[model samples]
Target chain A: MLDHLGEKLIARVSIGDFVVRFDLITIIMSWIVIAILVGLAFYLRRGLRQNIEEKPNRIQAVLDALIDVLQEQLLSNFISTSLARRMFPFISTLFLFVLVSNWLSVIPYLQSPTQNLNVTASLALLVFFTSHLLALRRKGGRRFLKGFIEPYPFMLPINLVSELAKPVSHGFRLFGNIFGGTLLITVVSAMIPLVLPVGLTIFFGLFIGLIQAFVFAVLAVAYINLAVES
Target chain B: MDLTLELGKVIRSINWTFIFTLLNFALLVYLMKRILFKPALAYIDRRREQIASRMEAARKSEATATALVAQREEELKATHEQARRTIDDATARAERIVSAATGDAKKEAERILAAARRRIAQERTQMEADLRRAYAEIAVLGAARVLDREIRIEDHQRLLDTLIDEIDEQALMVKR
Candidate 1:
């Protein structure tokens, strides 16, 4: 409805007290992103599966370049090549998934899933959990637990709060930018309803989307780097 | 049913969609790992390996080529040195032969000169002896004609002696 432009299109499935609401639009949009990524992946695979050419065609070269750039970013952050390579699949997926989700807004009347707090929150939480897991694996149970206490015993509460705040800030950062963009675009379109909305949409959808997605991935990698380092 | 994108009482905006989103992301991560990241990165890595090996092969071949060139150059230099030595040896041998031949020719010429002088001296002595014999015969004939008489053995001997002595003295004077 025009009255609640920012509202999620919800579909509810209830089982007594446990109510599971699926944001239908968001799920659909997420699936669309997923399919696109899958198709692109296969296109990449097809190129690779062929007798790997010394010279790649245009599309494959772009894909290869993107992957290589991500690798260079990962290598720069992580101290070890092995760790970077090991986390390549997950980190690259995080970047591509976020990038695609954010960019989906360029289509008319299509909402970016990243605009939803739920989606960004989930992604941030996922990153938080993954970083902690890597910390535990790298530092072991003893060292990982010791990180909470830190330089002094009294600092544990502050450290704990700060640690908890990481995901909160991380999630809200993306959510704020995208949701704010969506709201601004919606409000501006309603008032002006001129050619200006198109520019704003492209600016928000392409530029901001790319930047925010990159920031998110970099933050995620940074978090992982912090956890994995000695 | 009262959902607003407001900061006020934002608790309601957090809903079961979080669960769905979580599941979707997890599924996507798995699917993407299988379909996208793993294969693409694996291929990229493989291609990197191929490039590295090819470059290594090229580098090895270049090293081998360089070594071969150095070896050939050394061989060529050695051949040149050997040729120079051979030329030097041949020049030495030729000089030795020429010098020996020259010495032999000089000795032979000197020997021929000495033999010719000895032969000339012997011929001169023989010619003088022949002249002396002819002179004695001429004297005997002259004495017979001058005497114009038959003479005994003792007187003829005496006359020949006198003529021979006179001829000897005259021949000595002519030689001085």
Candidate 2:
């Protein structure tokens, strides 16, 4: 059981001539995270334009402060305010989703979706492709294409290798952190029923989870910033 | 547990070409974007704009107030300076009037005193003349009585002269 700590429980479904396999825990937990986010979003949507001015309720205040802080972080990272506002929806959503997903594992009998490489890759590739597409659209086809052969003809292959490595590193970084935490947690829990120590759970689930989520969101914004600027 | 076997499993865990996660995440982003972030960020942006405009208004009002205060101070200072000038002018005019009045009064007093001195001199001359005439008459009467006859003009004349000369020797003027 300790050796098989990282194994996923998969579910298989067939459609026409094809079959699809999904990690059951990740899928189930992904929906739960989505549901929670969606419900909170509905709560946020209520009374948006009303006079809740100066002094807002607790949840509204937190959301307000969170959005403001995130926007400032992007602006401070050297992006224009307009550009930051435009990117706010996507960047902040990523942060919220990742943060919730990372923290979800703190609950008993649950796991963070970030434990899966597939989801991490999806998120990293989202930023990766978004940045490149923005660059292509903004800089035009010729300039964007010429970016690979930048500085010299000899640098093209190196640039391509470096470009290919972005998604891999971006995805793997989160996966490694969350998965390692999960494994340690599992081994410790198996040693003692229900992960009794509690201290280790707090360290991995709360502390590392928050840091990784923050790092992921910031890196996503930075990558997008570089792409648009470059 | 062999690290090699575990490495193989981890490497095989990737389903690189699959679209399930890609679509799901795309949905999540779309929903999350549509639901949560859109309105919240918009509210924040609107609030910032309101704050900036309100501050600008406050600054303009403050500047206007300061300017008004300075203008009032300038007017007050001018009034004070004018009042002082008026008071100084009034004091100079009063002193000039007092000095002119004193000079006029002194001149009038001197003229009255000179007139009084001249009147006294004229009265003294008239009384001396009258006294001599009275003395001449008395002497003529006395000569008439002594002679027991009517007095002659030549005798009268000599008597009068002698009496006048005697009166001159006294050298005293009569008081009223």
Q: Write the residue-wise lDDT of candidate 2 on A1-230 in tens digits.
A: 77765566666555665655666667778788888888888887664646635556667776777666776664456366666767677777788788889999989888898888888888898889988997898789999988888789799999988877887898899989998988887788788865364877789889999999888988887777877776
Off by over 4 Å in 2: A47-49, A52-57, A192-196, B1-11, B16-18, B101-176
What is the number of residue pairs that collide in model 1?
0
Q: Can you write out model 2's per-residue Cα lDDT over B87-163, one digit (the tens) per residue?
A: 99999899899889999999999999989989988988887777778667766765665476457787667766765
Least accurate 10 contiguous residues by lDDT in model 1 chain B: B2-11
Cα displacement (angstroms), candidate 1, residue B73, comes to 2.1
TM-score of chain B of 2: 0.48
| lDDT of candidate 1 over A15-40, digit per residue (tens) | 66666666777888988988888888
As a TM-score, model 1 comes out at: 0.76
lDDT of 1 by residue, B37-100 (tens): 7878778788889999999999999999999999999999999999999999999999999999
lDDT of 1 at B115: 89
Question: Against the true two-chain complex, what DockQ does each candidate achieve?
Answer: 0.21, 0.17
- Per-candidate TM-scores read 0.76, 0.76
Candidate 2's docking class is incorrect
